[model samples]
Target: MASRFVDTHRDISYTKDVVRLHSHAFYELLYCCSGNLQYLLGVDRYQLRRGDVVIIPPGISHRPLFLEQLAEPYERYVLWFSQEFLDQVQVFCSDLDFRGGYRLLRTAGTPWESLGNLFAQGCREAERGAPGWQGHVCGNTMQLLVELHRACGKGEMPAPMVEQHELLDDLVQYVEVHLAEKITLEDTARRFLVSQSTISQTFRQKMGISFYRFVTQRRLIAAKTEILAGRQLETLYETVGFSDYSTFYRAFRREYGISPSQYRKLQQTQTIPPEA
Candidate 1:
């Protein structure tokens, strides 16, 4: 398997207006530098305070909720790496649950300093752009995982609990069935006979994402599948419930790092493997 790494430091101000529930094919480690942030995983919301580190695995839907418009910048360090990186480290530690789902960690003592230094070093190596920097970053990333596991052993942080609710399941199914239609939080709340706050609270508490984000993400996923299946991009925006092409274009690019047309071309050129 191949390995890759990408790291960035963002001093973000203003709110992320759209609720874009998205995921990647790789793991993400988010280290909050400062400010209060709400981290959404699935439908559950975790209040991320400064120095909090969240470990998110591949295929797990999540997003950072910048609900309130900030007076000052909200700083964070985000690192993404391929699954192979975690696999290589797993051979040495059998108890670590790197691939299970996601982890919310708070550093303690030695592991705290260790994880911080490793992340800082990884960022530096990434910025330096020297020869063999990839190797250096990978090594540090592995260590960061190890330090994270060590902290877990010491009970530095408690694992976030995920509870099941029957209403949430129905809500998800309802959204999926009505993907092509215009829906709002107020409408959903009214249909379910719950208040807007109840809908938002339950979604954030159980699914780790906002109701709005979940709907948009589902629509985008449908849009991508239709695009890859040879559907015309110009016709998809309206069908996907996006009112305008520009808004759809921006959201699509933000989620996939490419325009719908570019994504279509890339998918078309790739060789699909035979099924077993």
Candidate 2:
């Protein structure tokens, strides 16, 4: 019942090279249908492969790293939701051990498999706008939570994700708190009391990408949010900390498969003007 007259597609393909990361103000769920990814969570890093489901809460910064030399493309079905969408279920299972915290749903067990299927079906139904598709998706989301709880209760919990390098946690926090400011690997490394090499190496190992790449990826994600929120690119680019137009254009085009100007052109709607 909560359809934005303009619903963005949940399926996405990421093939170009990108180095930015992003966090939402609302909850988002990602199911990796194929390929591998390394995700940066709050103070931790996770190496996610096929069959792994990642849940990113509002304000949690995350980045997707490049695939290995022998790896394939990274494609996934993602569902985005606001807090109000799932609050109704809180009353039904407040006492569950995994109640309020986010989790990574594995593809190994029966429960996770069910959740995957339900998610796939819900996306299909939502796209089709079947008789009660919105409600169906909302319902499937609740069921997925239930299955997650059952899996946790039965003691099939995956290890609590930990950043590969302990200091990488502090680094992520620093970058976000300073998202709009000028940031560089050397400056951050000095501030954190670590050598540039250590900082670069540790960040890459812990976050599955280099420090510079992570910052860029975060900026790109910020740009997308600004586009969705209907902001002008000239201001948004600076707001997200890009140094120059050429770099921003290259990063935006590479990350999203289209130039920023083109993206604005495609999303042009009279209701909200994306350009200043």
Candidate 3:
């Protein structure tokens, strides 16, 4: 059986656009090495600084928003852990709680140093893949989480940098609740008592994406989640707001580089191994 519990990588000069606002079936821990970006966690937005850490739980929609041109390439260490891996760590560290929505740790002084060291060590182990590397990475991850839980207990977490925009937040939440219906920008603008241009500019200026594109991305993410849950691909297009299977198929292929059926088969063949 595979002994790997976490997938880890470091991006030195990452400048790719994460167009899809999607969720995962596992945990995501991101340590910002150097970057200037705002992160959208659900409806909340955060301005990330160097040494900031963001922890996202499974099934929560998230993506980074690049409102302006980056003066420097974004650098960060990203770690992905299976739910089973975290569950095992939780068993021994019962005081650490993992049943939360998301956490943004803005650290300084000793806590920042410790977390950065852990992230670097984990990345190295993952890269080398030496003998017993899996165990080493697992230990490092547990320690990192434990440290984070302690930091939270000590009140090191900070509030989101950007104040919540009531209209935009409500509109995003509205889209999430009514995602199954045939949603249109005109209808959304009318419901929110705003002009179509207002809605369009809000999405473009604030979210770095168009309103229609945001809705479509959300729907595609929902469809992807349902497919992972073993839903019938043929029955999902309409349910997820796509007019037909062909449209859904084309969008899915365009966004994810594979057909829905192909994605399902790929997932099935590479299911993460359970904890021993």
Candidate 4:
């Protein structure tokens, strides 16, 4: 395995349509500088505020839920590190919980500003690429992790949960269960005993997208995940709810800017075999 693999960057504005629910093969840490959004982490949702930090482990699906347009540009700092790098860090601090599922740290009364500064410093180091910048970025990351551990130890501030609309939550779960099947808004409405208009309006108001669009995004995400896992692309569309090859090919390329075969080859080249 490589000695270290880390990437850091800051996003100033929001792209509501392009931001789809997805998972990574590495750990992700996000600090909300400013945002009006709900975050979908696994099965739970969180209403994010300034100074809030979110940590997610590999293979856990997540995305920002844009319920409404932001008055200000949604700003955030994101850091991604491979598990190999985290394993090295854990040698010094084994008590830290990086694999205990997703964490939402509310920075109320905590040294959140300092934590945010660490994120900024890491981003700068990554972007400048000066001599010894990797070590500096790693050091900042370690200190940030240690500070977060200490903050969790305080146990004074608890993570606040978002009050999700029960119907919307059920709708999402239903879609997940039926992702491989042909799902329609009318079918969902009839199943839930509500009018089709209600279902359409609910998804538009709560998810910031039409019901069909959300389903398409989810299916495409699933197909991408399977591709990364080394699945054959020939019949992958049917398994992910795409009716035919051409439809899947067009949608996948449109959403990801590359063909599925191209994406598979790119990932294969970038992948590093684990040390024996």
Candidate 5:
């Protein structure tokens, strides 16, 4: 979260017992107002209860993996922004890792957590003051830098932790761009003129998962994001490479902790739908 490069405050949505969604492009911060929920982050999945928060970073595909039966994917607020907005703040966080990721940084005083709360609180405070709504969001965004400084500590930022610099990022970026088309490792590796083993090995080395798994997770996430965005089920499913209806449904549920149809229905009644 202390990187000095370009990033965006990607999303800050309030869930009202509706569909819990995740995306591939940006980092996500889930601040639970109440209830319990499980999230699939990267290859390792985890859960969070009340007052619990989680961070999902770029390149790592994540989605809701579980939720309490009584909570209807509601009562949660999210602040999703890029880690790059803190170019100045990066200078202060010498102890943080520069390469960037969704590391579980102590949850409370960590750079991710503090900035998350600051952003979420700012978003809420902005709604209280109507005249400067836009400015309030903007100002709060700027304040996110200071929050990072406090959470990351004055220690020397850790070295970039990313292992594979090429394949993993390339593959994830490919998935994001080709979410609407059928994608396969053979075709993907062919585009890069590398062997399947190379693709698989490189992907696992950096992402800690197989290329195929990453692709499936990415596609399911794309379909989920599209559903949250109000796209038709069949259309989005096919667009993201699900060839069969039943398979799509099962895979979506396995990854998201809920059915696609249910998510779409909940989104319709909620506030602004999800955006990737």
Candidate 6:
């Protein structure tokens, strides 16, 4: 079995507000210790209350909006770990859908206290870095997952997650996979059986970007990866779904503030130093 060595834990108290649109390649669990914040996940905006737990899957775009002026810092504990770690825990609790997007586990009853303790323990173990700390952290994470499963089973998790979130997630993935193809908004809407307006609205609300801009930026990102890998710029445009060089050049420049050629030359120069 492949092993994963990535684990992160942070108990942060943000004095300033936060706003950004991004995604991760690992699972994230946020324990709201004390703070009222707005969390945007997919097309849904949630008012996160104290004692609320938010679970986010990999590659799902989400952002947290903090209060501009706060009497106290927005406090929360964030834990991020590889899916492999979640898989190991899932072996013991197989009914849970770990890959599901945006699971909200409300803190209530005994489970709430138990989860808080688990998060606290995990944070401590991670920070202490004592002998066998990794094992202790994993143990705490496993217990936390188990508790969340129990809460979901009892329907205490609520309907914070819905099919629309899952659908939007699938839509994003589909676009990524079909990036090289001449996939249009209409094509996506037709493929997913959703109206163009709904798709546009979801992108705006969740990603804070329009569908066209999102696709163009994603293509530029993909192109940058290939260019850094020494792929020729000649075919990079078509390979990454751009219809023409002029269009690709404009989009790349607009997104990166640098033309593709300039970007590639910069990457090459960084890798190859001048002769002494």
Q: Which order, best to worst by lDDT?
A: 4, 3, 6, 1, 2, 5
Better of 1 and 6 by TM-score: 1
Each candidate: RMSD: 7.6, 6.8, 3.9, 4.5, 11.8, 8.6
Instruction: Put down candidate 3 lDDT per residue, 1-276, tens digits, no spaces.
Output: 133367777975445454457776667888988878778887687888888888987667888777355667778898888767877887888777766778788774544556888999999998998999888888898888888888778765564466456677888888989999989989999999999999999888777789988898888878877897888999989888999999999998887777888777766665522210
Ranking by TM-score: 3, 4, 1, 2, 6, 5
lDDT at 89, model 2: 71
lDDT of candidate 4 vs native?
A: 0.79
Quote each prediction's TM-score.
Answer: 0.63, 0.61, 0.84, 0.82, 0.44, 0.60
Enumerate clash totals for all models, in the order shown: 8, 7, 0, 0, 17, 0
Q: Return the top candidate by lDDT.
A: 4
Off by over 4 Å in 3: 1-4, 13-19, 95-97, 109-113, 271-276
User: Which residue pairs collide in model 4, if any?
Assistant: none
Q: Report residue 135 deviation for candidate 3 (angstroms).
A: 2.5
- Residue 271 accuracy (lDDT) in model 1: 19
Q: List the residue pairs that clash in candidate 3.
A: none
List candidate 2 segments past 4 Å from native: 1-14, 17-19, 67-70, 94-99, 109-111, 160-163, 166-170, 173-187, 191-276
Question: How much does candidate 4 score in TM-score?
Answer: 0.82
Off by over 4 Å in 4: 1-4, 14-18, 91-100, 111-113, 149-156, 244-246, 271-276
Candidate 5 lDDT, 1-276, residue by residue in tens: 221232223242233333333454344556655544444455444445444445566445665533324444435555545454444445655544423656433344333444456656665764476785655655565566455444455543332232334455566667778766777888998998989899989855444567777777777766766775678787677778878778888987777566888766654443222332
Candidate 5's C-alpha runs over 4 A off are: 1-22, 71-74, 82-84, 87-99, 105-120, 152-275
Expressed as tens digits, the lDDT of each residue in 152-252 for candidate 4 is 78876676776556787888888889999999988999999999899889877766678998788778878877887777888889999999989999998
RMSD of 3: 3.9
Which candidate number would show the highest TM-score if scored against the true structure? 3
- Residues 1-276, model 1: lDDT tens digits: 123444433335455443356655556787776766566665466777667788877556666666554444567676776655667777887676677668787653334744666777888887897999888888787778778887877875655444344677678777867878999998999999989998888777655578887788777866866676677888888887888888888988876677888766654544111100
- Candidate 1 runs further than 4 Å off: 1-19, 108-114, 158-187, 195-213, 219-276
